[model samples]
Target: MNKSLSRLESALLLVAPLLMLLGGVLLVRYDDQGWDGVLAAMAAHPARSDVGWLLVAAGAALTVPPTAALAALVRARRPGLGATALVLTALGWASVPAYAMGGIVMEAMAHAPDRAAQVAVLEQFNDGRGNAFFLAAALGAVGYIVLAVGLARDRVAPAAAAVLIGLGGAGTLLVMAGPIRALLLVAVVLLLAGQAWTVTAGRRTAPASAVAAV
Candidate 1:
C-alpha cells in the first residue's frame, strides 16, 4: 500500500509541475495581448472580474498538488528534507497572496492611474514580506541536495532516478544565489522531467542487498 501510494504521489509530482509550466507559458505568450492590458486594467476590475485572472489562477493551482506530494514524500523518508520542502512550499504558496495584492494595487492604479503609485505597488507586491518566497527558493535548492543524498543512500528512489531531481533542486538554488532567474526556468524544466521519469518508472525495485540492509 505504501508503495502504491508512492507511485501515485510520484505521478502527481511529475504531472502537476508540467501543467503549471504550461500555464506559465500561456500567460507569457499572451502577455503582450490581454495580460498586459489586464494588469493595466486591474484597477478597473480589482476583484479579478476578467478572464485573465483565470489563466494566472489555473497556472498557480497546477503547482500545488505536486508540491504537496513532494512534501509528503520528504516527510516520510527524510525529516530535514521534509522541513526544507515545507519552507519551499510556503514560499511558493505565498505568491498567490502577493499576486492578489498586485491585482488590487493594479486596480487602485486603474482608479487613479498614477504611475508612481503603480510602480510602488508593483514593487511591493514583488518583494514585500516575500522573504518567504525567497526562502522557498533556497529551500528548493536544499531539497535537491537532500534528494541527492537520499539517492546516494538509496533510501527512496533509485540512484539512477536522482539526477533530474538533484538538478532541479540545484537549479533552484542557483537562482537563489543571485541574478540567475534564467536558472529558475531551467530548474522548472528539470523538475517536470524528473517527476515524469519517476512516475513512469513507478516504484524502485529494491535490490536483494537493499532488502537485507533494511
Candidate 2:
C-alpha cells in the first residue's frame, strides 16, 4: 500500500487532535478571563497554565501529518479548495510560535514588578509587531474552513463534520476573552472530529495514504 504515514507520523496524527482538545480544555479552565486571567493563572497555577499552552501549541503543530494527508486527499479531487486550505493552514500554524511567545509574555506579565511595567510591555508588544499575528491566525481560520468545505464537497468527510469544522474555524477567528474563550473547546472538539473523519472516511478516497488515513 502507498502509505503517507510511516507509523510514527500516523501515531502522532492520532494523538495530535486529542492533545489539542485536552489543551483547549485546560486553557479554558484557567485563562478564560482573557489577558488578565491568563496572567493571573500564570501566577496562580504556573505549571498547569504552561502545560495547557504546551499541549495546545504542540498538538496544533504536530497535526502536520494528518493535515498533509488530508491535503493530499482533497487536493486530488478539489485542487482549488485543497490548495487554498493547505496554504492557509500552514500560515495559520505560523501562529503557534506567536502564541507561545504570547504565553511567555503573559508569564512575564504575571511576574512583572507592577501594573505599570505590565502595561508598558503590553503596549510595546501591541505596538505593531504583535498585531501581525492576527493575520496569521485569520489565515489559519480561513484555511480550516476551506479544508472543511473541500473535504465535504469531495465526499472525503461528511457534511456534518464540515459544518462543525467551519463553525470551529469561525470560532478561532473571533477575538474572545473571559469565559467566552471557552468556545475554543468547541473548536477543539470539531478539530478532533474533522481529523478523525480524515483518518477513517477520507482514507477510503485515496489508496496511497491508507497508513496516513488520520
Instruction: Give the whole-model CA lDDT for all candidates, comma-separated.
Output: 0.51, 0.64
Q: Give the lowest summed-lDDT range of ten residues in model 1.
A: 24-33
Clashing residue pairs in candidate 1 are: 42-107, 43-106, 43-107
Please write out the lDDT profile of model 1 over residues 32-112, one tens digit for every residue.
123345445454455433233344345445555655554555555556766665565445444543443444445555566
Q: What's the distance in Å from true for residue 7, model 2?
A: 6.0
CA-only RMSD, every prediction = 6.2, 4.9
Q: Tell me the TM-score of model 1.
A: 0.59
Q: How would you encode candidate 2's per-residue C-alpha lDDT over 1-214 as one tens digit per residue?
A: 1143356655665687687667666652323224565566677766666677688778878876567666667888667878888888877766765675566557656876676566566657666787677677787778888887876876666778667666665455433222454576666666666555545543446543553675
Off by over 4 Å in 2: 1-13, 28-37, 173-179, 206-214
lDDT of 2: 0.64
RMSD of 1: 6.2
